[model samples]
Target chain A: METKKKKPRYDFILILILAVAGLGILAFAFLTGGGGASVEVSVDGRIIAVYPLSDNREEVINTPEGKNRLEIKDGRVRVTDADCPDKLCVNQGWISMKGQSVICLPHKLTVKITGEEAPESKGADIVVK
Target chain B: MKDNKGKNNIRQKQYIRSVTSHGMLVAMAIVLSWLEAQIPAFFAVPGMKLGITNIVVVTALYKMSSPSAMGINILRIILVSFMFGGPSAMIYSLSGGMLSTLIMILLKKIRHFSITAVSIAGGVFHNIGQVAAAAVILNTDGIFWYLSVLWFTGMVTGTLIGILSSQLVKRLPDSLFSLRSGGTK
Candidate 1:
């Protein structure tokens, strides 16, 4: 009989709070991710290159760790190929909005989209900050 | 002397019983891990898993002692990693498994929280632990961006595993644990 003890009200409330909090954070992430103008590529936390989303090109980014082929087309950026083990970056498909990124953990690679400010013009400013 | 001999026999039986049960639980968890891996990368978010294996761990926590559950979990992680993953994957699993099991054990100790609540905490902390491991290993905070999505997924999956575990804990006979705890008596 003890095994069937009714669940305490606290459990329900706690679960509800956790669920609502999770959804709220997800919603905030989506809302804050806005339309951006350029693609920024970084390896080991250092920005290696920035390309305007307007351009269409395919280039292989060679990092000391590995290589990832970046493709920018139709105002979107994606990793078409990678030599890393997981290939999660390639699987991440595409990103065209601010704050959205395709990360490859093995290669320590991050491809993120940045808003408005031209990447090339403010690249040095970003480093200083 | 006779009583001591009987007690020793009971202890031996309990040891065998616990080992067999732990082996079964570990096997079930490994099967679940492999099954989860088979599910094609359904979510675009990398490193996200449906976490079905948690059902076994949650059930173990309620049916068995915390130390026993923790043992089963660690054994499963090591075996599953060897079978289907690499050293990096093993590190992530170890961190997540340890943290989540600790949280679940703590939550269960509170007495007020239900099985579902404990399971939810386990699920959420599992993702946090994994993300933290990845951030440290990769040396970048950008991975934190996935935390939000991972949280949402964790909550949803946690609810499911919770429901399943509660049902399992209800159905499994009490004799299973009594054999372990009541051995000396």
Candidate 2:
């Protein structure tokens, strides 16, 4: 009877390398800023967006113009009736999560929800666990 | 005729043909990912669409070794992004493919489970990976709602691809390929 060698041993070594590499990357993610709590953005019953809670955000009112009239009333977002067409800001429901964004293209106004900025200065959407 | 089975020394080269080798597998995977770009996977329910490329990922996982599958996956995501999937596909493809491969390979180690089972496991893991990425990107747990939908899709697609791969692998000649005489050692 003829004999045949088993499949090449290359696969075992290659798998080891890949596994180690994958684990290394995961570990790096944990060690880096990824381990930090994430950010979420919501608008009333409908969630428009979500993003990291990093400080890399700016409030429309915080700008030099310093005129931000958008606010949350009775758990609903109100645009204070800006000059935006379709009154989209009025359509935007609420901002109770991270990364939530409501744009009023015509009025040149927007409502953004982020982790660092919420009802209170301290982050409330996320409980670090 | 039976004598040909053991005597045809030159016929033992199909198992690892260069065109079907790991590199080719990687290239085809990339091409599959790129080609899938034209397809409209989104049902318009939300920002996310149903990812169909997991079919190819599951198939590749079964036909090739774990590392080879990983190789194919990484290349597919990179090449697909350069071609059509844009940043969104890049993120989901890489995460889904990587984690799926991990689950498929680990399941392959089980003695009794078949490739179909491996594919199911891969699909589940792929969803897990996608959801994880979604969580990271959205930075919120609200995106978890998408998992149930993905799981249903995964089960069906995974089974189909797994069956196809198993049949294909079965038909392949179980032997090591030899380099062509004109080819170098």
Candidate 3:
């Protein structure tokens, strides 16, 4: 028998790189997401309503397909119920961070947490470089 | 004339064999898609799926040609959409499937990337394509935030699929892919 050298079969380093990249992106997303001032509801891409996070309220969004119950409480918003088939939006639970959203694909409805204009920034032409 | 006839016979056999295998793989893909849908959404994040059908696609890519894998994926998405999904769902799946398959094919050409790495790329791109489609259709960028969560889940599911398909590629008899001894190249 002759001794032979074999090349490594798996690219484990690639997997590690991807894992770290994914985690880094997730951390960035979390760190940059928060301080939402209001919850906005939209149907068919049109803004239907905007509610302040300070107020706890329940509202129903009616789309061409069906109805979705949007609930905002304690600065977080969620879809409590929907007539859509998958009910994925309802399952999405609550989201409070800015840019977070609960989307009902079937109904074409979206409940999103948005960072409204800061009071100081309102009616001010703040220049940025 | 006799030699030409024999060659034609072998070619016909190979064609039949390839067709049958493609059909079987497509059926498997459709079944996997359906089975995945049956599972309740355990995660609280939207656009999250176990991507069980990806196992079939990855197996096809390694066992067969790129076109075969792409065809199986597209056919499965269309058929499943007809049965269980709506027009919007079809659009999302089509975009995701096409993008993922394209990426996997490109990755397969490179020597350093293993099957798992290719699969992870496929999974991640699939989510990206879907989210892009959603952002376009829904006319909002807020939902793009889901990409953060989806990328993580894609990597996890892609690893599982890559491992499973690698096993299948190793264990399955080559005769399953090439029935005739000396068929097509």
Candidate 4:
């Protein structure tokens, strides 16, 4: 006896639901990019420092994995340089908008822009690190 | 004595066939994973993957027993991580792989959803596991904020994988799968 193959059926409703949900989240991520006044830097998930966007300075972040140079100027922040192999963070460019972040996965470091009024909680408004 | 010998011979042949089939699936999964790693992330968000490897996992789940599918999935993660990634990568992949596999298995057992739904759930759970691992390693709750975006990516990728796997399974020859035992439905 031949074992008949079953034809695969797709649930269009499930796909539609997922598509709507996905688009909603993507929209939220983009729409929330308001101007931010401060940038918070974290290494190994701990907040190392918070620099005001009003200040123009370069700070070198050193962690056990590697080192990264963060440059803050003109209300924008970016990783100017890093020793990590990919250097993805350096290429991510500057972010001065709320909910924007620059992350170095190799070094497990993250820099995020925050509003002038720091939230009492240390958690990020949007986790992109 | 003759009957026992014949049965033993058939069992040995089945075992060899099963191992070979599982090995082929693992190799396919590894190649897909490697291919995915070569493509630059489309989104700026970290840890985003196309999840093409999931096609093999989903196919395995439907075509073989839960244990066989799971064994193949775990083996693929370990081998791929060791070959292409660092210790941290291994941890993240392991966490994600295990969680996704568990969710898929549960969903499969329920039989209420289509393969696409199961794959989507697997994708979402995989991201959650990775985020949880990152949060623990980094010691920050900040990573949780990334979950929303990850979930969005997961659903999109998962749906694609689900469609691909369902088609692949339909095309596969029944003889390639062990018919003697260790298959559900």
Q: Tell me, by lDDT, which candidate is best.
A: 3
On residues A14-73, what C-alpha lDDT tens digit does candidate 2 reach at each position? 334444544554444333322222233332223333234443432223222224345444
> For model 4, how does the per-residue alpha-carbon lDDT over A1-129 read when each residue is reduced to its tens digit?
333546344456655766677667556766666778778888777787777777788888887899999898998999999999777788778887777777787988988887665434454332222
Clashing residue pairs in candidate 2, if any? A40-A97, A40-A98, A41-A97, A41-A98, A41-A100, A43-A94, A44-A94
Candidate 1 residue pairs that clash: none
For candidate 1, the per-residue lDDT at B5 reads 100
DockQ of each: 0.40, 0.06, 0.40, 0.26
What are the chain A TM-scores for all the models, listed individually? 0.83, 0.35, 0.80, 0.73
List lDDT for all candidates, in order: 0.81, 0.50, 0.82, 0.79
Report the C-alpha lDDT of model 2 over B1-185, residue by residue, as the tens digit: 77897556545554346345656656666665555544443332222222345445554555445665677677777877777655755786678778888877776665345666666566656766876765565444333334544555555566666676666655543332223423322
Question: For candidate 3, lDDT tens digit of each residue in B6-101?
Answer: 999889888998999999999999999999999987777777887889888888888788999999999999999999998889999999989999
Can you tell me which runs of candidate 1 are displaced by over 4 Å? A27-38, A43-48, A62-67, A82-87, A114-129, B181-185
What does the lDDT come to for candidate 4?
0.79
Q: Can you give the lDDT of residue A116 in candidate 3?
A: 87
Give every collision pair in model 3: none
Candidate 4, Cα interface RMSD: 4.6
Docking class of 3: acceptable
Q: Which is better, 2 or 3, measured by lDDT?
A: 3
Q: Rounded to one decimal, what is candidate 1's iRMSD?
A: 3.1
Q: What does chain B score (TM) in every candidate? A: 0.93, 0.72, 0.95, 0.94
Clashing pairs in 4: A127-B145, A127-B146
RMSD of each: 4.2, 12.6, 5.5, 5.5
lDDT of 2 at A118: 30
